[model samples]
Target: MTPGLINGHLHVSQHLLRGFVPLAVSDTSAYLFKWVFPYYETLTSREEGVAATLAGCDLLTKGVTMVADGGTVRHPGVVADALATTGIRAHLGGWSWDHASAPPGLSMDTTEALDRLSGAMDEVAGRHPRIAPLATTIGLGMSSDALLEGAKSLADRHGTFLDFHHSFDAGEVESHRSSFGDDVTPVEHLERLGILSDNVRLVHQIVSTAAELDAIQRTGASVVRCTGTRAARDLAELRGRGIPVGVGTDTVNVSNTSDVLRALHVFAAEIREPDSDIPSSGLSADDLFDMCTVGGARTLGVASFAGSLEPGKSADLVMFDALRPEWIPMIDPVNQLVLSADGGSVESVWIEGELVVDRGRVIGVDELALCQEAEEAAAGVLMRMGARARIGRRSLC
Candidate 1:
């Protein structure tokens, strides 16, 4: 049994939007402003619940027992309710953005944004004690300085983690430099504001420089990198510097899958590219596996409670079927796990000493019915958002 894999970052609300957004490889702005924001604006609380349930069910079945949800600006209670039903451990919260250009009905001033986040935390903590609060800011470019400070302060006060996107694209870095009017990079800017810390977890960071990497290492801040972004060298460099690095399946519309094993496979292959100056012996299959298990747990600040098979730790682990064809020639266990196996080989999963999946099937949920529900929900949401017309169809379903 391996430690139950932790998804370092995910957006459950976007699960239904998989394949609905036609994204170009380099177009981050279109992925966010054109499709994601519009889709988010059209979601009701009920639909959010459906989406969350579908996401949680899929992740749990794939051996992800815990996730750190990058929240939407609406209906976090519905997210928590869905997590409760799926019996998945998660940190949940609402979006906190103080920018004037935020989507309609989603934008708030600094004070209002902070208040909304704090109130959501209190509400979720009181309503469902199991779901932890995740203090969030939209990002360095979109969030005001005051909002960033407030979000970090809130996380510190509540003893939780602060999550945000940072330096995910070169354009974002350029925009931040333009907005802040400083020659310093985005990571330096965050350092100047005292926002970088061990409790803060930044996502993407694909455009980071050496100085920024040093700042991250110095501040002890963690990073969650998505393999779909193809920033393999960045991930390896961070790991080499002894910084905590975790893997993430960004979003359904972005990475197109919640399978942690797939992310791990991509990460392993990318880091081992030929003709690289870095030695081939630098990263082993075991090291990549640790990134998904212990590294992810540490990045999420849940290492003491999960991550390993210790006496006092939670009994969270996955059992892969050794009898599968993928494991028939398993010469090196770690190598096979990292290079050959996918989520399909996951035979069973346990979280907090309770069996959530057995024999490759979720214990109680009716998956077939859930698929029907998800299809209906997806159709309804797309139609309501007027996104149906945007979908490019080449063949009849």
Candidate 2:
């Protein structure tokens, strides 16, 4: 038994984008301007609601007790309501960017953007005890200076973390660099804006440099590495610096599944580019397990109350079926969990003493009906999107 997994970063509004990406999608820029933005602009409230419920159901069944959203582009209130029904704890925030690079109908004026996120915070409040609202941004490259500063202030006022995407892929790295003339790194830019404090959960650290990693460690900001679109690179280096780190599934479009255990299995397979400063032998199964549970809770800033199987902490537990092949003999629990077992072995899950998942199926919702609604919702959005998405896609690229 363990504290349920925490997806330290998630894109709640992009759930329905799964399985619909046009074949042969390119890097981040094309992905953002062509597909993700268009889908966000066209998604209806009902579609977002169904997607949120679907995401929550999948997460709970996969032993995810807490999820911190990257940001939502549409009706965040509807998404909140749907997750509330699934009984999963979450950290949510709205998305708005003022950069000219932001697609049409997505960007807002500086003040309007800040106000919109603040309003989203208000809307999420009192919705559920487990659902918290925080400050968020699309990405550093797509956010203006004022927006970053404003988000920091908002997070300070709320005493919460500001979840934002930073260096992930090469395209995003170059784009953020083009806006600055100085030789300073990305983390340095945040330092100049007074944004790289303890109240930040920086997502997608694939492109971070040694200097940037130093800055992150110095500032006490946590890192949430997404294993969906990229391999788990330099995770040991992050831990070597004593930086709090967690793992996430990122977006459904790229990930296709929110199962963190399976995500880690893929992560273990794709591990490469180890730093020389770290151990010659890379991460172990136990280390991966820690990242999914307690380390994730710390990254999401809920460690004081949850994340471990302790007496004073919240009651969140995952019970696996020992009779399953994955748990057979149980010679090494951590090894079996991180390397062999999938989420299917999860027999039940308890979040805050509430039985949300029972006997390998989520409770309080018809599994058949949910899948049917998801299919209908996805179909509805795909029809409106026209050639932007199709059913015969081979790769999201």
Clashes of each: 0, 0
- The whole-model lDDT of each prediction reads 0.82, 0.81
Candidate 2 deviation (Cα RMSD): 3.6
TM-score of each: 0.93, 0.93
lDDT of 1 by residue, 1-397 (tens): 7889888888998887877666565476667677878888888887788888888888887889888888856888888988778888888787788888877757688999999988877767756645888898778867899999998998998888899988877777898888777588999999999999999998888788899999999999998887655556565677788899888887987778888888888877766777554344567787777777889989888889877778889899889888888887879887888888888888899888889988877776777777777777777778877767454333322
lDDT, candidate 2, 316-335, per-residue tens:
99988878877888899888
Among all windows of 10 consecutive residues in model 1, the one with the lowest summed lDDT is 388-397
- The superposed Cα distance between candidate 1 and the true structure at residue 227, in angstroms, equals 2.3
lDDT of 2: 0.81
The C-alpha stretches of model 1 lying farther than 4 A from their native spots are 23-26, 275-281, 389-397
| Candidate 2 weakest lDDT stretch, 10 residues | 388-397
Q: At residue 89, what lDDT does model 1 achieve?
A: 85
**TM-score of structure candidate 2:** 0.93
